[model samples]
Target: MKAVIINTSTDSELVSADVVELSNEFNTFAQKTAESILAMGLTVAKAKRLSASDFETFCKLIRYESDSSAIRKLEQIGKRYDALHRHVDKLPSAWTTIYRLCTLDDSAIDASAASGALNPTIKGSDLIALCGAAKSSRGAKNAKSTTARAPADSAVPNGTDMVVRFTTTIDETQIVTLRRVCKLLREVDAEIALSNKLDAVLNQAVEMKEAA
Candidate 1:
């Protein structure tokens, strides 16, 4: 060509675009690699006979602390991956979302996906809340089933009014302590009633005051 049209600016723009594309590819590859590693670690953990301390050592060697949130979640996923992996593609990128999905069965996972519960608009905590609701519903169903199966031996006698009963929630330690306290209170009340001990103590105090 008689006049060489050298648009250096155009060449520079093309090079910059290529660099951006390459960077994006690298980032994608890195993310995929990280996901694979996490999945592999979870899968191998199933058969590993390592104790808590040994596992912590392994996690440290792998640069993820044993007690780290990420490791804890990955362990949960690993333990239930067989049931969970079927719906993995529908899960959000967050580990929390993945962990929530792991708690559910395939049917629940499919239903949630169909309802778009795992979409970007919904969050991991929202999915966990849904799981909680599902669990409560299941518990209610189980309670109903148990009530329906009550044996004749559990029925109250004809003349005996049903013993006054109320349900209350208590932790294991609280329940144990409450039982012991109730037993002690009953024993003390019986001893006091039999001896008229409280009346005697009050009478003695009044006499001592009059003497003073």
Candidate 2:
């Protein structure tokens, strides 16, 4: 396959050809969507090598959502698990599940695979929980800076007492919108947790109330 080089000209012909070919191949393996997605990821990563603008163009050409996390996640999966060609069948069919698996370190991945936790039957939520556990464990091991801890503690006035829990149900469409908003928020502040995001919004609301 000839590599598609994205440039200022945009090379629409080459990009279009690659997209057609990849989409055709993906359709051929509809039953094995995960494998097809990985293949697409590899191709997308190669095609978008020039720049972020090139990537956005590529996404547009493929009719993908602008700034889709799916594109980034697929690229990461292709790069990280490229060596596991023979073990592809063992991987989960859902791209989101594979994305979660990709977030895990090699040791955690290996351990999960060895224990059957990384099988095709695994749920995305379970994989998310696994990633969270791994992240928390790593954070605990690496958190030696009191200064880092102090800022977070000082951010909230009453610590645990300031925390409040509320529950609400959202339909599928609303859930999708919420996820997109969360993604945008993360782009603005990558380190902010979802809880902190809510707190920031609430704090702003309180300030608005005081001004009124």
lDDT of every model, 2 decimals: 0.58, 0.66
Instruction: Flag regions of model 2 displaced more than 4 Å.
Output: 1-32, 51-57, 83-86, 140-212
- What overall lDDT, based on C-alpha atoms, would model 2 receive against the true structure? 0.66
Best by TM-score: 2
lDDT of 1 by residue, 98-138 (tens): 66666776666667777777564467668879788667777
- Report the lDDT of model 2 for residue 154: 52
> TM-scores of all models?
0.47, 0.50
Task: Output the TM-score of candidate 1.
Answer: 0.47
Candidate 1, number of clashes = 0
The superposed Cα distance between candidate 2 and the true structure at residue 150, in angstroms, equals: 25
The backbone clash count of each candidate, in order, is 0, 0
